[model samples]
Target chain A: MPAVTVRDLTRRFGPFLAVDHVSFDVEQGEIFGFLGSNGAGKSTTIRMLCGLLKPSSGTATVGGIDVGRDPEGVKRRIGYMSQRFSLYELLTVEENITFFGGLYGLDDRTLAERRAFALDMAGLKGRERTLTRDLAGGWRQRLALGCAILHEPRILFLDEPTGGVDPVSRRQFWLLINRLSESGVTVFVTTHYLDEAEHCHRLALMHSGRIAALGTVSELKNVFAKRAVVEVRTASPMEAVRALDDLPSVEKTSLFGTALHVWLRPGQRATEPLRERLDGLGIHAESLEFVQPSLEDVFMDVVERAGGTAA
Target chain B: MRRLLFLIRKEFQELRRNPRMFPVIFVAPVVQLAILGYAATTDVKNVPIVVVDADRSPVSRDLIGKFEGSPYFSVVDVTSNDGDVQREIESRRAWMALTIPPGYGDAIRNRRPVTVQIVADGSDSNSAGVGLAYASSLIAEKAAEIALQRRPPGAPTIGSIEARIRVWFNPQLLSQHFMVPGVLALLLMVITTVLGAMSVVREKELGTLEQLNVTPLKRWELTVGKLLPFGVIGIIDVLLVVAVAVLWFEIPLRGSFPLLFGLSLVYLLCTLGLGLFVSTISQSQQQAMMTAVFFFMFPMIYLSGFIFPIENMPAPIRPFTYLIPLRYYLVIVRGIFLKGVGLEAFWKDALLMLGWGVGVLMLATFRSKKTLG
Candidate 1:
């Protein structure tokens, strides 16, 4: 059985549906990523999967326990870390680890063993006495993760864990996540960064409380976004993008820094249509060529096609 | 049980580490004890008296000496002229004026009734009335002494009825004895309710509530764990207040210590439960504090008859005092402190407190569970 199986789960706050009929499955020991914008219901879905919230309709099971029926059973098998720092800032690093460990009913012997493992994993081994608030942002994030995993649950849910950390720290955190997955722990994480999503074994892109796409990164790139993207380098990038906006062959135009990224529909040749349009408008076109579509390109195309309504 | 202990231990650790809360938890109680001990009182003391001795005899001197010796009376001035007596009282130097008539010495020798005038400032009637009563009792004692000296040995006293008043507990009727225990109730309310709400709401603010909810800890265990530390603080506060009341304020704790401690523990559940209920309804620590003050603390303090007498309250509002847990607690504490009553006499109040504690805690626990869900 999958580590998590969510079938048509829905959660409503009053009249607003925060998670609407969303369904997905996460394989055991697989690193599953949920990607979306700020209010795209990623946290809501994760909360339900972690048994912190009860779904308004449908059902979900985490670690073979029904979330709606035996949420406490699901709770015993999963660990969750929120986007914000959730450990007691006034407590020492070791104290935080022990508190959470005890909450999971770990005995003293097992707690001591896990404490050593967690401290080493967080690179907070020697700073056991240091207050959590005194630690730097990256160190605090790592310590929070360490505390969450002290009980060594079968599954872990991280809701935007590396939100504000520096790039180097972000990469290190990802390495820790990869290690956890490699050790047979099913990891479900959410992030807005497309690069982080690429590291996941399989991911679901959510938009307006609905799953827009769910597949491997390469599969999404091949399936939803099959059209080629024309990268335009021009002296006047704004005028070049504006000139390409009205072209019959150009599907969409997006400006990335000083370059213009133009999407062409299937069976449309970007070489002839793009050059003719820009030359007619007297815009300086330095270069134009077809490029492989990134995950970001697939996401933008899917969300736009999904109609981007408010949840 | 071990999980609850760990959670409680963690709570104390956090409390100890917080620099701002250190003085609040420890030092504030002592300072408040000192302030409330001396300032809150109704026992009359040091009533300044002006004696106008027109007779200037030995008898008049004895009367002056009597007023000077009493702890309740301070003889501010002595003059032969009645006008000086009035001047002394009108100038606010004295609260009462005792005037001896011209024949006051002769009348006392003959065992006759002499009407000595005692003038008191009526503007502040409470203290002035008590002062006059003290003066009358002293003079009456002196007259009884003279009559005894003049009477024949073993002769029957002429047609008189002597009524002796033996005041039982708190003979002096010192207000500190009353207010010290009352202040303890107020202190416990502030700590358990306000601080309790702050503790719970603070977890929500820090987003730790989300982390806690995902743990295997049961809901009631979590609630009890979050509240057990404050309950310990409440017990410590009770002990501190009791020590201050007995040692510093000199108010005797005549009842059973175990009884007082046990009853206080039950009462704490009501306050802490109220605190949890406040946090459930509030979204932030500030909101929790305000709700604890306005919604929980104010109504409980007012209707508990801590500062006001329940009987004197309006007919419409009097019955609501029964719903206040502090009302039953105050009765129990005061009974244990002054009257030395035990479970036999106050078993009903104890039962009511238990009922209120269980009822409030269950409701709060339900509300918190719903809020979390």
Candidate 2:
């Protein structure tokens, strides 16, 4: 059975539907990524799965226990780390770890063993007495993750756990996540970083309280984006994009820094015809080549199709 | 149970780390009790009086001397002119002004009732009333003595009633004995309610509460754990303030110590529940503090009959006093402190407080569960 099975799960905040008929499954030991912009119902869905929120309708079963019927049972078997660093800022690192460990009902002997393990996991082995607020942002995030998993839960739900950390720290945190996944722990996480989606074994892209895409990175890039992505580096990429916008062959236009990436309609070539059209518009192009659609391209197309802004 | 112990330990660790908690938990109650204990007195003494004697007779000097001899009245100024007495009263130099209207010894010798015109400043009505009562009683005694001395040895007494005013419980009527205990209750209410509410809402603001919500901890465990440390601190505060009341302020602990301490525990639990209720409704620490003050603490203090007597309150609002936990607490504390009353006298208050404390805790726990969801 899948580690997490959510079928037609829905949550409404008053009249506003925060999670609308959301459905997905996380296979055991796989790193599953839930991707969405802010307020796209990622946190709400994670909350429901973590047994912290009751779904308005449908079913969510974590570790074969019905979350709606037995939320406490699901709670005992999983670990959760939120976007906000929720450790006690005034408490020392060891105190936060011990407190959470005790909450998870770890015995003293087991807790002592895990305390050392958690410290090593967060790269905070010798800094046990340092107050949480005095630690750097990256260290705090890692320590929070360490606290969440101190009980050695079978499944982990991380909701934007590296939201505001530096890129280097984020990379290190992902490496930690990879190690956990390799150790046969199902890792379910949410993020806004499209690049980070590459680290997940599979991903679900959410929009407006609905999942728009669910597949591996390459599968999402292929299935949702059927058109060819052609990058054009021109003297004026904005003018190049404007010139290409009205073309019947060009399906979508997105400006990527100094280069303009244009999605050509299916069966259209990205060779002489596109270049000749741009050159005729007085838009001088430096180079034009067909490139594999980035996950950002897939996300933009998915969001645009869902009536949200592409970029 | 173990999880609760851990959570409570965490709470104390946080409180200990905060330097500001020392003054609020340990020092503030003692200082407040000491200050409000002195200021909240109803017993008035040493009222200044201005006397204008127009007669200058031996009888008039004898009456003025009697007023001077009493501890309640101090003859601050003596003048022959009535205008000086009026000026002394108008300028607030004297609390009361007495004018003898050219009274000759012949009025007393003839056994006629002579009225002495006295004006008392009514700005502070409480002190003014006490001062007037003292002056009237002293004058009545002196007049009665003179009347008896003039009467023949065989004549029957005119006044048939000879009543003795015996003030029981507090014969000396020291307001400190009553007020100091009441101040202890007031200090406990403010500190526990406001501080407890702030601590819970602070966790919400910091997002730590949400983290705990996802854990396996039960709702009651979290609620009781969150408030248990503050409850312990509140008990310590009660001990500290009561020590100051009994030892420092010299307010005797008349009744059973265990009864007072036990009732105080029940009262503190109710206040902590009130704080939790305030926090459950508020979204921030600042909002919680404000609600704890204006909504919980102020109404509880006023309706609890801490400063104002419940019987003296308006009839329509009198029934609401039964709903205030501090109302029962004040009765219990005052009964134990001054009246030296045992459990039989205040068992009803203890029962009501017990019911109110449990009801409030259950309601707060229900609301907190909803908020966590």
- Model 2 lDDT per residue over A146-212, tens place: 9999989999999999888999999999999999999999999999998899999999999999999
* TM-score of candidate 1 to 2 decimals: 0.87
Which residue pairs show collisions in model 1?
Answer: none
Candidate 2 DockQ vs. native? 0.63
Q: Candidate 1 chain A: worst 10 consecutive residues by lDDT?
A: A302-311
> CAPRI band of model 1?
medium
Computed on alpha carbons, the lDDT of every model, listed in order, comes to: 0.86, 0.89
> After best superposition, candidate 1 residue B235: deviation in angstroms?
2.9
| Candidate 1 local lDDT, B42-157, one digit each (tens) | 77888998988899899889988988999999998888888887678788999899998888989887778888899999988989889988999999988787788888999998
Give per-residue CA lDDT, model 2, range B139-168, as digits (tens): 888887897897888998897576799998
Off by over 4 Å in 1: A223-226, A234-236, A309-311, B48-125, B128-163
